[model samples]
Target: MARRRQAARAAPEPIRATSMWRVDQVFLTRKGQRVEVICSLVNDRSGLRNLSVIAPTEDPREAVRHAARFIAGKGNVSTARNARVRWTREQSTTLQDELVRDEQLEDDFQDEFEDMLAAVRDQMR
Candidate 1:
């Protein structure tokens, strides 16, 4: 009877598992005329972090404005007419992996306390 009760109290799988990355901060980077995206992240249970993807032709300032708009909660990124920066969950994970492999993220940025996506979002205004 005790064993059965204990089994019922066991934690779920999601609680046991560690995350790959948490999309925290997003700011644009420029390489001369080219534009790239630097997605700051918190790499769970591993080293290295950061994502850089070439998104040229997109004005860097415009990209920041779009991201800021989403973070500011002024518009929706999901609605058909709400087109902005878009990436799938799978793609986000892939970008996290790429950044980790390249050691692009800084240790300072890895600090979970400073890397809250919510904090960044709130500051978008």
Candidate 2:
């Protein structure tokens, strides 16, 4: 009975996890001639966050404006439309490769933290 209870109390790890948004598309459009649009989303504790149609320009001022708008939802058409947008098939594969690299970095950080914790505990002992 105690064993079963212990197992039940143990938290289940995430089957899949990503710590950052995957860049869906990067576009330099004619309408926004000097601007490049970036689209991406991140899923975290707050829920899935959507960033759409960020218009970045080579000019410093425009780039700042674009970043602010992107963060503040000025160009989030998909979220307003109530859609879950996805990247192209090719982009998805590329994002998967990037995610693998990110996972390795995350693991490395976790290992470092564990070592630091062990050293602290040793000092306490």
lDDT of 1 by residue, 1-125 (tens): 98999889957656534444545555455555755555554545443455556654356554443433333242211111111233333434576643432112223223322334445556766
lDDT of 2 by residue, 9-111 (tens): 9698776544533222222222334543334444433344444343445542343335334533332222211212222344345756433322332333234
- What would the TM-score be for candidate 2 when compared with the true structure? 0.25
- Score candidate 1 by TM-score against the native: 0.31
Q: In candidate 2, list every pair of residues with a backbone clash.
A: none
Q: What global local distance difference test value does model 1 have? A: 0.42
Candidate 2's error at 10, in angstroms? 14
Output the lDDT of residue 61, model 2: 37
lDDT of each: 0.42, 0.38
What local lDDT does model 1 show for residue 105? 26
